[model samples]
Target: YLFSQRAAWKPALTLNGFLSASKRFVEKDLEVCVAGRTFMITGANSGIGKATAIAIAKRGGIVHMVCRNKDKAEEARADIVKETGNKEIYVHILDLSETKKVWEFAESFKRKYKSLNVLINNAGSIMSQRDVNTEGLEKSFATNVLGVYILTKSLIPLLEKSPDPRVITVSSGGMLVQKLRTGNLQSERGRYDGTMVFAQHKRQQVVMTEQLAKAHTNIHFSVMQPGWVDTPAVANAMPDFHRSMKDSLRTPEQGADTVVWLAISEAATTNPSGRFYQDRKMVSTHLPLAWTHSSALEEQKLMSLLEDLAKTFQPH
Candidate 1:
C-alpha cells in the first residue's frame, strides 16, 4: 500500500517552477494567506523555523515565534519585520529541550491567543554524543519528540477554537532508513549515533501524528520533510555531509514555502489527515523490509509510551 503511494507520487517540482508557473507565487512569494490567523512555530529564531515565521507574517498572519535565545529571537524578529512589513509577529521564550518549560510556554501562549490556527513543530536536535537533559531523558528525544507532544496537547483546545486548525510537523527523510529500537530509545544502552538518534526521534513524530489524527477529527495533522534545506542545523549537525548536500539543498525561504502552503492552501481542506509530504506534494513514508513486519507494532508501542509519558508529566 505504501509503496504504491510512493510510486504514484511525484514531488512538487521546484519552488522555481512554482514561482514561474504563476505570478501569485511571485507576488505572494509563495506565502499563503494566514492573515488574521494565529500560529505558534517553535525554533522560530533561526533556520527553517525563522523562514516559516517570516512567510506567514508576509501573508499578514499573527505569528508567535518560540525560541530559546531572546537575543537571537530579537534579531530574527527584526529581520522578519523588515522583510515582511507585517508587525503581527511576536516572540516567546521556549527551550523545547526542557519539558517543564514547554508546558509553561504553552499555557502562557494559550492565554494570549484566543485561537491557534497552526502549530508548526519545527524545532529539532542532533547531538554528537548522548546528552541527558534536566528531565533525565535523552536530549534529542526530549527536545524533538516529547516537547512537541506536550506542547501540542496543551494547545489542542486553542486549535479546536480555530475554524481550520493545522499541525504541521517537520520530520526527516532519514526516517525512511532508520527503525526505532525500543531498547535504546534514549541511547542510554550504548554509544550514541547522532544521525540514528535523530532518525528515531523523527519516526516517533510520524507515529505521534498518526495517533493524533486518529483521535482528533477537527484538527488537521501532517508531517513534512523539507528536502535538505541549507540551514545552520544541517551545517552544524553534519558539516562534511552537508558540504556535498548543500549543492542540491533549498534555501530557507524555499523550504518554508511548502510548510506555508500546507497551513493555508485550499488543497488542505480535503487532504487526508496524517499524510506525509515532501516538497509541496504528499508522499508515502514506507518502512523498509529490513525493519521487519514488526514496524507497525513498534509504532503502536511508541504511541503507548508517549501517551503514558504525557499523562505522567502533564496530568492536567
Candidate 2:
C-alpha cells in the first residue's frame, strides 16, 4: 500500500520533483566544450537516452548512439544533427537482449574507435508479460541486468585507458522497493510479476555498479535514477501509471539532467564511485527502514554469477 500511495512516491518522481531539484543545479557545470571526447549512449533512439545524447552532442562531444532499430536511431540522429549542428553523431544497431551480439558490438567498437571517454548505459526494458529469450534468460533480465553487466564489463579496459573515463547507468528510484535476490536473478521462479522483476533487475544494476567500482579504480561507476518522465516506454509498459501521472511526469530532458551532470560535471566524479544519485545529489540506494539491504554474500553472488555468464558469451 505504501508503494501505491500518491503521497509516498509521486512527490519524489514527478515534475515538481524535477523543478525543485533544478533550482540547485549549477549552470556552469555543463559549460565546458567536449570537442574531442567520445560518449556512447545505449537506447539512444528516444526518451532519456536521446536527451542525454543531445546534451553531449551540443557540447561538441563525439556521440555514438546505440539502439536496437536502425530506422528510429537514424531518425533520432537526423534530429540531433539538425539541433546541435555537431555532425559527429553516429548510430549503431544492436539489441540488448541478444547478449552475444552485445559482446560482438563492444569488441568491434573497441577496434573501430581509439577511446571511449564515457559510456552511458541508458537502455532498459520492462515487459508486461514474462518472456525468456532463446538463451533461456528472462527478457527483462537479459536486457536490463545481463546486457548492462556484459556491456560495462566488456568496455572496462577501453574505458580505463581513456581520460576522465566514467560509466553512468540510468537506473530508477523503483529499485528501492527490491532487495538483491541473486538466487533467481533471471526470474525463472514462481508467479512472474513484471514490475517486481524489473525492480529487481534495477536493483541488480545498483549492486553491479558498486561491485564494478571496487574492482576497477581507474573508472568511475555511477547509477542514477532519472525522475519519472513522459516517455513512450513508460506509456507502453505501464499505461495506467502513465495515464494517471501524465500531468505530473517530467520531460525527457528534465529526467536526463542528472545523467548529463554526472557524465560531464566535475562535481560528480569528486564524490566516491559506486554511490547512487538522484537530482544530481548522491542518494542512498536503499530507502531508510525499507529492510531492503542484501547481505554482502548475496551481493558477491550477483557479481560472480554475472561474471561467469559474461565469460561464457564473450568473444574469444
Candidate 3:
C-alpha cells in the first residue's frame, strides 16, 4: 500500500539523506553545461516529473514540460523559475491516459519544436479499480504503455532531427512479474490487482523499449527505474506503501538524478541501447517465461495496437 498524501511522506527525506546522496553521486551543475539541449518530460507538474524538469532547467537546458493540468504546470514552472532562475521552461498540455489527445498533442509539439534532444516517458498511474479511456483501452495500459508507444512514434521525425536522439523511459522495479495477459490485456474478463497489473505494464514498457532499439538503429532507447521514489501515484495506488518503505525510498530530486545522467552524461553516448538502468548505472533484468515475454512478439502486438489507434486521429 502507498500513502496518498504528501504530508505523510515529506519527512522521510531529511538533510542527512541529501548529504549522503551527494557523496554517493556526482553533484552536477546542469545550467552551465546543459544549455541548448532540449528535453520533453511527461507529467512535469509534480513528483518525479517536476523534479526532472527542474533538474534539466537548472542545467541550462530547455525543458518542455508535458502535463495534463495547465494550472498545475504553471505552478510547477513558477516554482522552478524561482528556485533556479531559469525562464526557458515551457509547458504543453498532454494527457497520456487519453490516447487520441496524446497523439494530437505530440503532433502539435513536433510542429512547434523542430527537434527534441531527449524524450522522457515518465507519466504513469496505478488506479484502484479498472477504468477505460475514451479510446476504450484500459486506463493503466493506455497511459503507461500505449501512450508511450504513440508519443514515441509520433515524435520519430523530430527525434531524428537531432544529432543524437535519446528516448529514456521510466519503468519500475516491479516489472519483474510473471507474464503478460495478451488475451485479456484490459482485464475485461477477469479481476484486476493494481500492483500486479501495473508491474505487467511496466515490464511491457521495458521489453517494448528493447524492441524499439532493435527496430531503429539511429535512435538511442533506454529504460530506467528511479528506485521507489516517493510520489502521489504510489500513494494513490496503495495507501500503506509509503510508511512501510519510508527509509528506503529516494526523493524526487534524487530519483531524477539518474534521468539527467542518462540524458546528458558523455558516458551514456557510448552505452548500448535497450539496457535497464537504476541509480545512474546499468543493471540486469529478470528474464521472463517463454510465451509471454518474447521481445519480438510484444513489439509486434504493441505496434499493431498503436497503428490502429493512430489511424483514428489525423497526425499533424
Candidate 4:
C-alpha cells in the first residue's frame, strides 16, 4: 500500500496522478463553512502554513497567525484579508523555540479568546547544523518537539471549551525513515545530522498525537504529512532535493488540503482520532522496516519524557 501510494511521486506519473488526487482532496466545492470557528496557526507567514490560513479564512473562520516575525505576519494577514475578505484575521508573534514564549503565547491566547476550535502546530525548522536555543536545547528538537508539546499542553483548557476541538499537527514524510529515540531525543549522543534530527522530531509528533488522543478522548488529535510541496521553506532547507523534485512537487494548496479538510470536514472529526493522514486519508505512520516499529515500552517512555519536559518548561 505504501509503495502504491508512493507512485504519485514518480516523475512521469505525478502531474496527472498527484495533481488530480490533490484536487479531489482539496474540498474545493464542499460548502463547509466555519464562520464562527477560531484557529491558531503557527508559522503562518509563508509556505504551507500561510496556505492553510488562507483556506480557513475563506471559509469565514477566525484566523490567528502565530509567527516569529511581526512584519511578515502582518503582511500575510493583510493579503489574506484582501483575498478572502475575512476581516477576522489576527496575529501573534512568538519564537516557538523559546519555551517561555510558547507558554506565554498559549496563556495569552486563552485569556483573550473564549474558545479555540483548532490549534495547528505548523512551525518547524531544519537547521543545517546543530544549534541550541537559550534554554540549551537543540534548535530543531526544541522548536519541533518540545515547543509543540508545551503549546498544546498549555492550551488544553481553551480547546476543551470549544464545541468541536481539534489539534492538527503538520508532520513530514521524512519521518518514515526514522524511529523514536526515547532517551536521546536531542541527538546529543551521536554525530548530528540535521535532516535525521528533523525526521526524528516529526516521528515524535505522531507519537505525541497518539498519546494526547488517548489521554483526551474528547479532543480530536490528528497529525498529517503534507507530501513534498513547492514551498520557500523546502527550497531553503533542502535545496538539493528541491532542485531535483521541483517540477513534480505539489503546490502549497495541495500540501495544505488535508490540513484544511481535517480542520473543518465533518468526515474527519467523525473518524477515529490518533491517526496520521496524507491527502485526506488516514495512512500508516511507519513504513515496513526493521527499525520503524518501536516497543510499547519505548512509547510509554517517550510519553513520560515529553510530559516531564513540558512540565519543566511550564511557567511558574
Candidate 5:
C-alpha cells in the first residue's frame, strides 16, 4: 500500500488547522437563502452531514436527509425542524453497504423527488476487517465507493434538470497518502489495513469527482477533506486516535463549515469544478512532491470497473 506520513501530518488535520484556514474564509459569501431549492445529504443523522443539514435548513432550503437508520434519521430531522423551524425536512433510509439496495433506492428517489439542487456524498464506512458482501464486494469499498457511485450516477438525469446543480463529496485527508488503485479495488491483496483501504477509496472518490466534473459541465462537482473531526465514526473506527486527538479535533459543525459554504456560497461555485477543497479554498489533490498521482488509464479503469459492478445490480 502507498503510505506517506508527511501527507497525513497531524497538525494539518487538527482543530488548529481549521482555525488557521478559516481565518481567510469570506463570511459574507455564505449568506445565501435558498427558500425553494432542495438538497439531498447522505448520513444526515449526525456529525458533519447533520451539521450541514441544519445549516441549509436554517437558510430555508428543503432538506432530504438520506440516512441508514430510521429512528436516528427521524430524530435528527426532528432536531433540525425544532432548531430551524423550517419543517421541510424529509428522511429516506438505505444502507450504503447494500449495493443493490442503494441502486433501487436511487431509482425510487427519482420517482418521488422532483428537484435535487445539491447532492452531498457524506456517508462513508471504514471497516477493521475485510468483510465481503453477498456480491463478493468488500464492505468498505462497497459502502464508500460503489454505493456513492450508483446513487450519484442514477440521479444525474434528475440533477441535470435543476438550474444550479452541484455535487460535493466529503473525502478525507488520509487519501493524500494513497493513489487510485484500480488493480485492487476490493482490498483483496496484502494485510487488511482499514485506514489504508479507506484512504484508497477516498482517493478514488477525488479522481471520480474530477472525472465527473469534466464529463458534466452543467453540474459542478467538488471533493473536500473535512480535516479531523470529533464524531462517532472517528470514535468507533479509531478509538485510540480519537482519545489521543480528543482536544485537538474540530467539532462536527466546524468540520461541516466548508461543506455548508460549498453548498450555499456562490463564491465556491465561481471556482473551477472537480477541484479539491480545504476549508473554503481550493487546494491541490496531491501533497508536495508526493508520488500519489495516477495515470489517465488508471482513472478510466476505475470508472469502467464501477460501471461494470453497478450494471450487475441494475434493476432489469
Candidate 6:
C-alpha cells in the first residue's frame, strides 16, 4: 500500500521535469495590479529571488529588497526601479543565517510598512562543509529553515493587516528524496553530508508551510520548488551539475514564474493553502522512495522544534 501511494507521484515528477525544460508553464497572463501592495523578498540581489522581485515591481507593487550586501541590493533595486518605472523599491540589509538579524529586519519592516501583501522567503545556501553561525546552528538549516520561520512568524501580524496576504517560500525539487529526521533536526547525530542537509532543510520548509497554513488559516501559505534553474548560485554551488545541464536548465525568470503568479494571480489565491507547487500547479511532496514518506507525528514534532527555536530569538 505504501509503495502504491508513493508510486503514484512518479508520473508527476516526470511531467514536472518535462514542463520545466520546455518552459511551457510560465504564467504569461498575469494582469493583476498591485499598485500599493507591499512585497518583501529575501536574497533579492540575484538569481530567482531577484527575478521575482523585478516581476513584482513591474506590476506597480511596493517591493522591499532584503539582502545581505547593501551595494548589491542597491544596484538590484535601482535596476528594478529603472526597468519597472516604479520607485517604491526599498532595500534592507540582512544576513538571514543570523537569527538576530532576521528578527531585527522583520521588526524594522513592520515599523515602516502598515500592510504586507506578500512575503517571499527566497534566500538559501548550500554549504560544501558543515559550518555554524553565531547562533550555533548549522548554516544551511539556519538560513533556509529557521530564518524563514523567524521572519514569517514575526511578520504574521503585518500580513494579517492586508486584505489578501500570501507567503510564498521557495523550496526545491531536491526535497523529494528527503524525509523529516525528527531526532536529528540539526543533523548532529550522524555524519553530515552537505547536499543531504540542504535537502533536509528544503523538506523542513515544505513541512513548515503545511503547519503555518493550518495555524493561520486566513493567510495563504504556499511553498514551491523552482525546479533546476540556471542561476549563478547553481553554477558556483554545483559546478559539475551546472556544466552537464547547462543547455537544459531553465532561466531565472522561468524559475520565478510560479512565485510571481502566486503573489498576484487571483487564480492562485483561490487554490487551497499549504500546497507544494511547481510549474504553477500543485505537485506531490514525496516520491516513491521508502524513506520519503513522513508521518504526521514527525511533521508535528518538526513544527514544535521550529516554533521553540523561533521563540528563543523573538525580539523583546
The CA lDDT of each predicted structure is 0.80, 0.91, 0.78, 0.86, 0.92, 0.86
Highest lDDT: which candidate? 5
- lDDT for residue 165 in candidate 6, whole number 0-100: 94
Determine the C-alpha RMSD for candidate 4 after optimal superposition of all C-alphas: 2.5
lDDT of 3 by residue, 1-316 (tens): 1233233333323434444545656554332467888999999888888998887887788999998889999999999999888999998887888888888888788778777989999998887789888768889888988889889988978988886799999998777544544556676876888788888888878877887888888988999877677777766677688878766677788777778788887777578998888766676555322233555675577667657766675454
Per-residue lDDT of candidate 2, residues 137-244 (tens digit): 788988999999998988888998899999999998889888899888777778888988988989999999999999999899999999799999999999999998
Q: Which sections of candidate 2 miss by over 4 Å? A: 1-9
TM-score of 2: 0.97
| TM-score on alpha carbons, each prediction | 0.88, 0.97, 0.87, 0.93, 0.97, 0.92
Report the lDDT tens digits of candidate 1 across residue range 224-288: 87766788998999999788655566688777767877787767547899888876677666543
What are the RMSDs of all candidates, in order? 4.0, 1.5, 5.5, 2.5, 1.9, 3.0
Mark the regions of model 3 whose C-alpha exceeds 4 Å error after superposition. Answer: 1-32, 287-295, 312-316
Give residue 281's error in model 2 in angstroms: 0.3
Of models 4 and 6, which has the larger lDDT? Answer: 4
Q: How do the residues 1-316 of candidate 4 rate in per-residue lDDT, one tens digit apiece? A: 6565345334322334456665555444346899999999999989899999999999999999999999999999999999999999999999999987888888888887898989999999999988899998887888999899999988998999899999999999878877888889888887888888898999999999998999999999999988888888889999998998878888888788788888988889878988999778888886653357888889889888878887887788
Q: Whose lDDT is higher: candidate 3's or candidate 5's?
A: 5
Regions of model 4 farther than 4 Å from truth: 1-17, 23-29
Instruction: Arrange candidates by lDDT, descending.
Output: 5, 2, 4, 6, 1, 3
Pairs clashing within candidate 4: none
User: How many residue-pair clashes does candidate 3 contain?
Assistant: 10
